[model samples]
Target chain A: MNEVKKLPLQEAANCLTPALRLAVDRLPEQTARAAEELRLRVGQPPALSYGGQETALQTAAVTAADLREIVARAARDSVHSYADSLRQGFLTLSGGHRIGICGTAKVENGNFEGVRQFGALNIRIAKPVFGCARGVYEQCCRGEPSSLVVLSPPGRGKTTLLRDLIRCAAASGARVGVADERGELAALRDGAPQFDLGGPADVLELCGKQDAVMHLIKTMSPRIVALDEITSAKDAAAVGYAANCGVEIFATAHALGLEDFRRRTVYRPLLSIFQYAVEIALEEGERICRVHPLKEGAPC
Target chain B: MLKLLGAILIIGASGALGLSARQGLRMRIAAIDSFLKALSRIESEITYRLTPCDELIALLAGENDPYAAPVFQDMAERLTHNDGLSLSYKWSRALREAGPACGLREEELGILCDAGSFLGRYDSEQQRHSLRLTAARLSAVRDEAAEDLKTKGGLYRACGLTLGILAVIVLL
Candidate 1:
C-alpha cells in the first residue's frame, strides 16, 4: 500500500504495450505486488504469473503483429543491434527486466543464427529485494573470502539475494566485479546502474558469462566476482578459473538443495569450486533459505 | 499616372508569386537531396554498425541539417513519446507533418512512408537493401524536381510578367 509496492508495477506498466497495459492496470494490488512475469503467446490471451501461481487475464488474444510491435518497442526500434540477445532468446530492457523470447530459431550450416518472428514473450520483472542479504553475509562470507554459490529453483529470489550480497561486499570496501550477462544484476542504463547496490561495482553488460568473468578478473581488479544462472560448461570452467586465481566467486544456480545441486553433470566443476552454498526456497510466503559450509572432499 | 501605377503593382505581385513558385520547387529538390543523404547514412549504419532505427533517427536529428533534421527529429520523438502508435504509423505521421514545411508533396511524402515501412521490420541485410532502394527512389524524385525547376523557372517569371500586363490592360 506504500511507495515500495507500487514501484515495480509502475515500471513494468511503462514498458507494456497499450493493450497489455489495459489488462495489467486492472490487476489487484496484491497480485500486482507479487507479479513476477507477464506471458504473451500468439493467438492466446495474456497471462500473469506471480506469488507462485499463474492467472489468465481477461484481455484480447495477442496476434503476430502485436508481438512484432512489442518486440520493436522493446528493442527501441533497433532489432539489428540486439542480434546477440535475440539469438539467445531473451533481451533485457532498460530497467533490467528480461523479455524471454520464444520463436523459430534461424539456423545456418548446422549452427543457430537468431530468433525469427517471436511468437511468445515472457516478461520477467526484476525485483531487487533491498536488505535481503542482511543476515547471510555473516554466515557465508568467512576467512580468505571463500567462494559461495547460491542455489534455488526459478523465481526464488536468487538474483535479488546475490545483488544485495554484492552490494554488501562492496560496501565493506571489497572491490566487486559483476558479469551482468543480461544486465539484470546492475540494471545499467547509459553506463549507470538503476538499482542502488550500496556501493559502486564494476559490471560488464551484454557480454557472455565465461568471457566476461575472465575479462573482469583481468581488467577490473576485484576481490570478488558475481554472475547469475551458471548453466553452461564454459561458465563452470570460467568460475573454476576465477576460483583457481584466488578471486572469490559468488554465483547462482537452479537447485532445490545440496543433493540436487551435485546431480547436474555440467555443474560438477563449479560445485567443487564453491566452499559455501546458500539454498533458497519459497515457503508460506516467506523465503526459507540457508548457508551451508561444504566439506573439502565432497563427492561430485 | 494612375494607370501606370496600377500596372506596376499588378506586375510586381504576379512576379512575386512566380518567384515564390520557383523557390518552392528549389526547396523541394533541396529537401529530397537532404533526405537521400540521410538515408545513405542510415544504410551505412545498418550495414556496418548495425544501428537500430531509433538510434539512427536520433543521430539524424542531431545532424542539424535544416531540411532533413526536423523530419528525423519528429520520427525519433514520435517513436519514443507516442507509446501506442506502431513504428510505421509514427513514421508516416512525421513525414506528413513535416511534408508541407519542406515543400514536399503528398506523393513525395508517400515515397518516404514506403521506405519507413521497412525501417525496423527486417534484419540488417534486408533493411540495408530496403534503404538503398528508398534512396534510389528519392534520388529519382529529386531529379524530377530538378527538371521541373529547370524547365519552369524562366517560364514562370515570363508568365507572371505577361499575365500582370494583360490584367492591367484589361482593367484600363
Candidate 2:
C-alpha cells in the first residue's frame, strides 16, 4: 500500500485527549500503525487493540473523570448534539472513529434519553483496507445489478469489505448513494468524504438508515443504495422497499453464520431482498467464507 | 527650594496613587460587564449551535476583550491537558488563574466559579437553565460593581489628595 493510503495513525492519536494521546504516541511505530481500537474504562488501565490482540497501556488507571473528558473531547464538548448517539450507546467522531459508551442508562417515556455516569469507552479505529472486496464484488455483481448483504461477527472486516465493493461499483460508473448512519462508511467532513468511496458515490452522513434509504431513492436517483449495519426490522423493510423500487441495495450485518442469521427474526424480511449473502471469516486472514444464494421465495 | 521639591514629590506620588485607585474601580466594573457579555455569548452558543464547550470557549476567548478572554481561552486549553481533573475543578482553576488579569475581586470571581459546578454535567436543557441562572446572578454583581464605582470611586481619589496635602504642610 502507498504511504498516503496507510492507516492514519498519527492523526488518530492527535484526535485523542492529551494523556491518552501521550500513551498512544509512546507506542512503538509498528504497534501504533497496527492498532485497531483503544479501549478505556473507569478505574481501569487503558488498552489498545493491536492486530486483534488486546494490549494494556502501562499508564495510570483510568478514572471516571478521565472517561468524561474523553467524551467531552469526542463530542467536541457538546453532549447535546450527541445525545441521540449516546442513547444508542456510541458516538462517531469526525474522522469516522466510533466511540462506544456504556454507562448508567437514563430512560424517559419508554425510550433511552441518554447516558450518565459513564463507566466504559471503546474507541474503534477506522481502517479502510483498499480493494479488499474485489473478490466479493466480482462474485456478487457478476451479470445483473443485484442486492447483496455482507455478514460477519463484530470486529470483522464487513464494513471494510462493503466500502471497497461500493468503490468498485462506483468505479464502473454506477451511481451509488451511501446511507452513512454513523458517518463510519464515508467519514465525511465539510461535505466531502474522508475515505475514497469511488468516483460516483453520494453520501448522507448521520441520518437515520431507513429514512436515508428512502431519501436516496427519491432525490439522488442512485442506481444502488448502501447502508451500514442493518439492525432493526424497520431497516429490513426499508431495504425491501428500495429493492422493489428497482434500486440495488448493499448492507452489512453482525452474525456468526447462516444458521445464526436465520435465527434472527429481525432480518427475516431482508433474506428475500438480497440475492446473495457474503459471509466474511477471519480464520487465516480475511477471506470470503460462503456466498450463499437464497432460493426464490425463501422462507421469511 | 529643597523643601518645595520634597513636598512636590510626595504630593505627586500620592495624587497618582489616588487616580489609579479610581481607574482600578472603573476597570473592575468594565471587566464584570465584559464577563457578562461573554456569558451571554455562551448562552447563545449553547442554545443555537450546541457547539462543544472547548471549541466554544476558544471562540469566545478570541472574540471577547483581553480581560474577559483569558478565562474562556485558558479553560479550553486546560480542559484538554488537566491530569484527569473534573470539569468543575478545571472551571474553578480557570477562573482563579484569570482573576488577576481580569481584575475581578475574589467575591466577584466566586460567582463565576460557582456556576462551573454545573457546566457540561447535565442535559442541554438543564445546562441552559444553569447558564441562565448564572447569568442572572452575574447581572446582580455587575450592578453592585457599578454602584461601588460611582460611590466609593471618588472617595478614594479625594482621600489620597487630602492626605498628600496634609503631609506636605507638616513637612513645610
> DockQ for all models, in order?
0.61, 0.35
**Which structure among the candidates has the greatest lDDT?**
1
- Candidate 1: C-alpha lDDT: 0.81
Cα RMSD to the true fold for all candidates: 3.6, 4.7
- Lowest summed lDDT across 10 adjacent residues in model 2 chain B is found at B82-91
Model 1 alpha-carbon miss at residue B59, Å = 4.4
Instruction: Estimate every model's Cα lDDT from 0 to 1.
Output: 0.81, 0.79
Give TM-score, chain B, model 1: 0.92
Task: List, residue by residue over A1-300, the lDDT tens digit for candidate 2.
Answer: 666643555555544657877887788878878888889888888998876689999998998877877786566556765665676778766666778888898877988767777898888877778888877777777744578888899877888888998999998789999998877788765476878899989998778887888888889999999999989888787788888889989888899977788889999888778888888877766465567776574222
Report, to 2 decimal places, the DockQ of model 2: 0.35
Q: Estimate the TM-score of every prediction.
A: 0.86, 0.81
Clash number for each model: 0, 0
The lowest-lDDT stretch of 10 consecutive residues in candidate 2 chain A is: A6-15
Cα lDDT tens digits, model 1, A209-292, are 888988998999778999888888888888887888789888998888788999899888776678888899777788976877
Model 1 steric clash pairs: none
